[model samples]
Target chain A: MKRRQFIRTAGATVAGIAAAPYILPSGSLFAATGNRRVGHVVFCMFAGGVRNIETVHMNDGNLLPNLITGAGGISPDILGGMTALPAAAAQSLQTFGTVFKEFRYAQGPTGHFNGHTTAITGQYTQVDLNLRERPEKPTVFELYRKHNNPATSALNAWWVSNGLGPYPSLNYSNYPGYGIGFGANMIAANSLVNADAYSVIGNTKNFTDPQLAKAAALRDFLDQQFKTLTPDSARLNTASDETRLKLFINSLYTKAFSGQFNDPLQTGPGVMNGDLYNIAFAEEVITEFKPELLVVNLQGVDVCHSNFTEYCDNIRKSDYAVRHLWDKIQATPGMANDTVLIVAPEHGRNYDPNTLIDSYGRRAFDHTGDASSREIFCLIAGPSSVVKQNQLISTNMGESIDIVPTIAWLLGFDSAIPSGLLPGSPLTAAFN
Target chain B: MYIHKLNIVIITLVIILGMLVSACKKKETTYYYEVPDAAVTGSSVIKPNQKSTLEYVSILYADLMGQSIPQPELTRMVTAYEAFGDDRIIEDLIIRNLLNRQDADIPTTPEMRANPTQFVDAMYQRFLVRKPNDYERMYWVQQIQQDTSLHPDILYYAVLTSAEYRHY
Candidate 1:
């Protein structure tokens, strides 16, 4: 039977029990206290400081009748690719039922690392740029795994990155009592592609002799590197649970390398090479794993620093990628009616263009020190479909950090969980 | 009946011969560039100014790139170290990996069947770049040895995945 059909049947059977309202214990602030509304949550980081001018506000100021204007609402354009708007509209276009059009990262540092860090932890602290350091607090991934899968061993969550940087270390945090054990599985998709040749070497731990098999050769090589490398001090879990995750990761690498799943690079829509490829991998994960909490980071829009023309081009492509990802999720056997997709840029770009010009003779842009860098938008859709169509919540000044609490709430964590761990609140308007 | 029995015998012989032939065919050889190790004399002593820095850099490079370090890249790193008197190549490569599109491959080790302390010590040397403190060694040894089912390879993997592996 299809996973969605089984979920529907099971949901129907448990509707009555799930509907009963019950208050959480006042003392247990970190534990989950509510019924799950959605079985899966896809949090797209939408990184690299997307600008409003070329994105949501592309219809305004320039005086052009952009496709966003044709869509009948000024706000829906922020969704970029969720709508039925043409990808080549005078501007990028996407449709969704609800948009926090005037959403703002009212708190936190506006740098790339800070924006993404806040997106995960929901606090706007000034973090060091140490590649080895994780957020000092409990991240949403940790809380979700701890509360939702306390006793289970299923791979419940993952964080996939378009590129490798400090981002891979964000899977968990340095919070006491909550660290690697509660971390999400992270995959740098670009790196996975490069390592394709090595994943088939088999599990090195299983081999007993150095000359017996390829596994031994791999083991010998790894041993040499291990002995000579200066270790990063970050702690990781090596318990039986972690071992399970490692095995699972190996399986994913093997599958990805085998080309059993679709690779955007091989079948791209004629454009979008970097971040779009990551989005395709994210889609594949949703279809294959159906992880309960999945976060994907895409940063191709950062190219705006030196190539505005390509940046604009990428913005349009990003719109299409989002739509494609959503469509894939909808078509997946288990995720169609069981997932909630939340999309938001980490932060926005500077208001004015930089002096640099691309080969296309277009003005380049940067996000360094502009107040407009704080401008951002968000869209939430699906599963409950509780949100009214074309709904706009412009009055609420939201922080990037609020996404974590909102995600926690959507996944059935107690209200206290967010209140205790985050400095922001849920996007309450999207819920029933 | 006698012809049927002969047919069955012949079929079984064919299957056994095919298995033997396939098994005896030349085994496919796997190639890997061996990373040189820094010799540690005592349980806690490490050779200073050892080649461990380059090895560490390669792993970090692989971690970010998601593949083994290409020979040219490795040569460039070694050359940079010779010229600069430091392994700053690691930092430069890390930044390059983050800024560009690439992949990586982390090497794997054999499981520790016994001698949990020795295995844990090896991990501390491999990933932590030092010997485990007395307390850490004792604790890990106790943890793994008592739980014989615990795989030592898991511990090594855990360290590789740690925050320590990422930062200076």
Candidate 2:
């Protein structure tokens, strides 16, 4: 009788474990990453404003062959045309997870800054959203940093952008209780570490670890005295962490000046742009830190405002970059088979073209907050055991603002964040 | 008449002798003591406003070169420093770069090692624009005495990246 009862209990527990997601709400199923399926995430903003027509809709030819499938044939005017020479992924990205084909950025001005802010903060900001100011809402970085167990380091979360501009400020926010202490490590990959940057900091003296430690211990003593007046910004990295970061940067300076700093992922000249460069840096960050959360922003497609042909080519380039990043992520030790990569545009471009015509005679497009500009697509690919495989959500089930909470929920830190901070719910339908 | 005059002169001379005798006595003097400035600085209260990026680079350049940096160099410095999230590491790198330059107005390591007291005092005045108080001076001197690898370049790097230096 004891054995029969034990078997019955075991069977009941298995059934309950399998059925808990349906019984409970999406976010309610798990409150922490240990119990959740996936913890690592890579949120890539296919930025600079892309339209669905060229991407998910494929009204032209299929520009993102590695990411989006079913729509075949390459666009004739696409720069250098499409080639399968380099396999983007083991398979189409949609095969690995779900694709939200008809997502929307429901609110806020359809500008790059506003879109990025909304996506990162999970709130709909207005026209007052300045390009240079920190987001009024707490960023996902803050939410992750402040709530994650074992008190994660700044290295565990990275924000890689094509350019600094307003991107540097997005790592943390001006929101009270969640500031620089909970910010991500930010790198403007395209501009921060070029040959010019190497020229500025190339020949810094290299101190040994023991020497640096002695200096750092002394610095710590000084910091203890100045802690009261040193702003939060000044203490973003701990004395030891700052020392480590300095050493890492010194290494980068050496590598950059030595001419070994170029990204190997940029296979061809046509694919060489800021987007891939930024992704290459993201790959480096992932390799180095194996961060739990890393957000990458690509802006090459913003060239669409002036040249439509270049815009199409840039979309393909971004696709290639994101594909290479995933490939790199899977190749990484701690992140392999564990990291979930989410790709979505901050917002979409307008449907109609303006007067500017490119050399290809194609008219240029602008994202002027039109109805079509509100539409976007979010593709989430992860392990088959974790993410819904080959699932397609075409009923406009999600919005752009949902990305923050969605990320938090996947990382299992959503419950720790105050509900009021994230106005959007996790797109649970895309997960198992 | 002659006798009366001689008697008056004698009396006057005696009185004058008495006055001289009274004027020949000794006198005393007084002295007071003073205290030196405290060991730690008053930097905590003085620098209230944060320096703008422009001010920071310009001042950093001037402090390193003993002359104001060119506007173009200053602009590049500001741009390079502002192009990241954490200014601490970047500023630390910039400090090292500036100090590594041949034109940097800093004492040599051997010169500093020869006289740690003067090195600490000069550093306090040079980078922090104040005197290293008694404890600061003593602690730094002892540090330089103990740690053979602690060079003036590293000390300059430390002070340049310190919170007190970032202000004002």
Best by TM-score: 2
RMSD of 1: 21.0
lDDT of 2 by residue, A1-432 (tens): 699999999999999899776542222433444354576999999989999898998876878878987756665666453433365555789988999999999888889999998888888889465656999989999888887654688888888877866777899998888888889888885676776676555578676777666766766655555533434453577867887676667666666667564545847544467787788878878877899999999999898899888888788788888888988998999898898999999999999999899887789999988988999999999998889999988887899889988888888777767657778989888898
Q: What is the C-alpha RMSD of each candidate to the true structure, in Å?
A: 21.0, 15.4
TM-scores for every candidate against the unseen true structure:
0.60, 0.83
Instruction: Report per-candidate DockQ.
Output: 0.02, 0.24
Which lDDT tens digits does candidate 1 get at residues B1-168? Answer: 999999999999999999999999999999998865544334433333333556665775555455677776665544333321112222332333332332332223334544566777776776566776665666666756665544534454445433345333
Single-chain TM-score of chain A, each candidate: 0.74, 0.87
**TM-score of chain B for predicted candidate 1:** 0.38
What DockQ class does candidate 2 belong to?
Answer: acceptable
